[model samples]
Target: MTLTQHWKEIVNLVTQGQRSSMHCAIASVGDDGVPNITPVGTVFLRDDHTAYFFDSYTSQFAKNVKSNPNVCLMAVNTKRSFWFSSFLKGKFSSAPGVRLYGTVGELREATEEEKSAVHQRIKPLSWTKGSKLLWSDFTQVRDISLTDFRPVQYPKMMEHLWN
Candidate 1:
């Protein structure tokens, strides 16, 4: 489906996934042609059909993207309440997961505005000891130009959910 048309839903799903799981898996091809997956928690989507993530603490991911820009990001809703309700209803009300396919752009220093926004996004965790350690020192970001979107599907469980 077109990203422009589904951007809102995609954003909502990603937000929910973030709340439930705290991170998304980004898959990229390594220099040896093997697939590598990294869990990134600082990803954020802009109004445009693009997403950005902090590049700190991801040396392998950065290297992989340099060699091959193509990547896939997957987010899953892992909240216990969501799963319990879905199980009780015998189907999921919404998609359980989503996959975004895109090409990652070169890493660059984050602007002051971008840094501020990132701080605001994680402000709730400011009191935690690990917050500073984990969120600080992020200087670079890689822009992902989303080109495709796919919903994770369970055929048997979803057969009657939509109707």
Candidate 2:
């Protein structure tokens, strides 16, 4: 199926994962040819096929992306209730996880609109003292052009659905 066809499902899965865990894992290859994975909480999906993440605390990941733009982002719905219900029913009502393969664009200053959106997303944590220190200074972002989407499937758990 085309990427656009699955865009809505992918976005839903990603949003669920973000709400559950507050971050997604981004994988890239380092200069030593080793795989690097970083948990990034500032990632935001602009649309079905495009996303961007603030480049505040991703020094290693940024370096890896600069050398090899190819990257994969994985998000999982880790809510206890969702997992328990799915396992009990022996099927997932929706995808449990999703992987997005894409190429990273150059890092540039985040626009005012982007900053405002990010602030709104993290407003729940604004009461914490560390929120200011951690979320501030997100002046730059790296855009990702999603090229592929893969849903995590458990054959035994949802064989009938796939069939």
Candidate 3:
């Protein structure tokens, strides 16, 4: 299918799911030009076309994006666990006028509105020993202009992978 059509399907899947958490991965060139992938949890979307994330000032993902400006995103719905997967990739940038990719950059500071939302949705989990904890007000937002997309009609085996 065309990119636009594929994007529509992806969006529908995400919107219909019970849980919609943003998946972010940044690729950094190693000493030998190989790429390293890091999974991060501080990601969000601003409306249907814009996306955002929160991270510490010293996060590797934020650092990598500032230096490289290349990033990838995946949104999955696992609650259903039948068959589903979606992903996105583009240059990681700031909302107003900051270009961050593979270097040190500031995370978007949360606004009062966002703070209100967090208070409503976030629940306090029990803390345990040996847990790596971090707190930051950094927010990262991006405007994604969907330029290309593709859809695959996978077999049952592959369908399980998507789910």
Candidate 4:
């Protein structure tokens, strides 16, 4: 299906994942063909089937993407309470997560708007030293052109949860 068909649902699940864990695991293939999964915290999804993430501390991921742009990003609502509630009811009120397959463009400087968005996202934690040490500077980004999506499924629990 085209992204437009399930765009809203994809967005919702991504938001849930972000709110729950503040990060996603993006898989890429390294030069030796081994898979690498990186925990990235700066993923930003757009309404137009695209996304981007800051590349501040992901040197290995950056090198892998340079060789092969294909990537699979998996984001799940990892909140303990959400999973507990689903287990109690034997069903999920919604899909718990999503996986997005996409191609990353060449890394480039982040724009003012993108920087501003990141600042806003981490504002609640801005006062903490850890926040300052970790999230203070986001200078580069790589744009992702999403091509496909797979909803996270738990057999019977996730049936009919599609948008």
Candidate 5:
């Protein structure tokens, strides 16, 4: 389906996924035609069918994207409660996850608004060591123009959710 058709729900699921799993998987193709999956936690989706991610330590992912700009990003709600309840009830109130297909833009310097968004997102872990190690520095970003999406469906459970 077109990402625009389900943009809001897609955003909600992706945000929940990041919160539960701490990251989403972004797939890109290397020059050798091998696929690489990068788990990134700095992805931020906007109201439009666009998103940007902090390119702080993504050397490998960056190289892959440079070679081939096309990318697939999969975001899933991985919360135990979400899974347990859905499986137990044999139904899902909404989609459990979504995969977004887009093209990565050239890595560019982040704007003040972008920087503030990152800081705010990670403010809860401000004093933590891991946060300092991973999120303390983010100056560059890569934007993605989302075009398509695939819903994660569990045979019977999610059959009606998206209908």
Candidate 6:
């Protein structure tokens, strides 16, 4: 399929809340000239075309992004019906690192609408006595521009889900 088509599917998934987590990979030149990939749990989506995630103040993923600024963000839907297993291989990527290259955007004052939308979508996912779902405190907003996108592959497993 065309890249744009792939992007549209991803956007739909995010907007529809079908995809729960974002898989972010940062390929940075290590001291030994090797590339490192760090996946982070994403938490926010400002719009269908924009999103954000929470990272520790001293996370290696954040550090790598600061240094290289090149990254790839991916979203996948693996919860399809049993009949659609053939499409289980479907995946999306943000065009190498061009989709999110450069410094991340700063967190701005969330509009009333933005806040309402966030509240409607997320209900504090409390799990334990001290386990509060981590949020960036409305201060860790990152902006990644869209460059390109594509579906990875089509697998029979997808039919089991999609079906």
Instruction: Name the candidate that leads on lDDT.
Output: 4
Worst 10 residues of 4 by lDDT: 154-163
Q: Per-residue alpha-carbon lDDT of model 2 for 21-68, expressed as tens digits? A: 999999999989999999998888876589998888888888998789
Ranking by lDDT: 4, 5, 2, 1, 6, 3
Error at 100, model 6, angstroms: 8.2
Candidate 1 lDDT over 10-86, as tens digits, reads: 89889889889999999999989989899998889988889999888777888898879999999999999998999
Candidate 1, which segments miss by more than 4 Å at Cα?
159-163
Better of 1 and 3 by lDDT: 1
TM-score of each: 0.92, 0.95, 0.50, 0.96, 0.96, 0.55
lDDT of 5 by residue, 1-163 (tens): 5666778889999999999998989999999999989999889999888999998777788999887999999989989999899888989877888899999999899999999999998999989999999888899999999888888887778767654
Give one digit per residue, the lDDT tens place, for model 3 in 25-59.
43455444456665544444433444444444425
Runs in model 2 lying further than 4 Å from the true structure:
160-163
Residue 28 local lDDT, model 4: 91
Model 3 residue 110 CA deviation (Å) reads 2.0
Global lDDT for candidate 4? 0.90
Off by over 4 Å in 3: 1-8, 12-32, 83-106, 124-163
RMSD value for candidate 1? 1.8
Tell me model 2's lDDT, rounded to 2 decimals: 0.88
Candidate 5 clashing pairs? none
Compared with the true structure, all predictions reach lDDT values of 0.87, 0.88, 0.39, 0.90, 0.89, 0.43
Q: Model 4, 1-163: lDDT tens per residue?
A: 6678998888888888988999988999989899999999889999889999998887788889889999999999999999999999999998899999999888899999999999988899999999989988789998999999988888799776773
Per-residue lDDT value at 43 in model 6 = 39
Clashing pairs in 1: none
User: Per model, how many backbone clashes are there?
Assistant: 0, 0, 16, 0, 0, 23
Single out the weakest 10-residue window by summed lDDT for candidate 3.
91-100
What are the candidates' C-alpha RMSDs? 1.8, 1.4, 9.9, 1.1, 1.0, 6.6
Q: 1 or 4, which is superior by TM-score?
A: 4
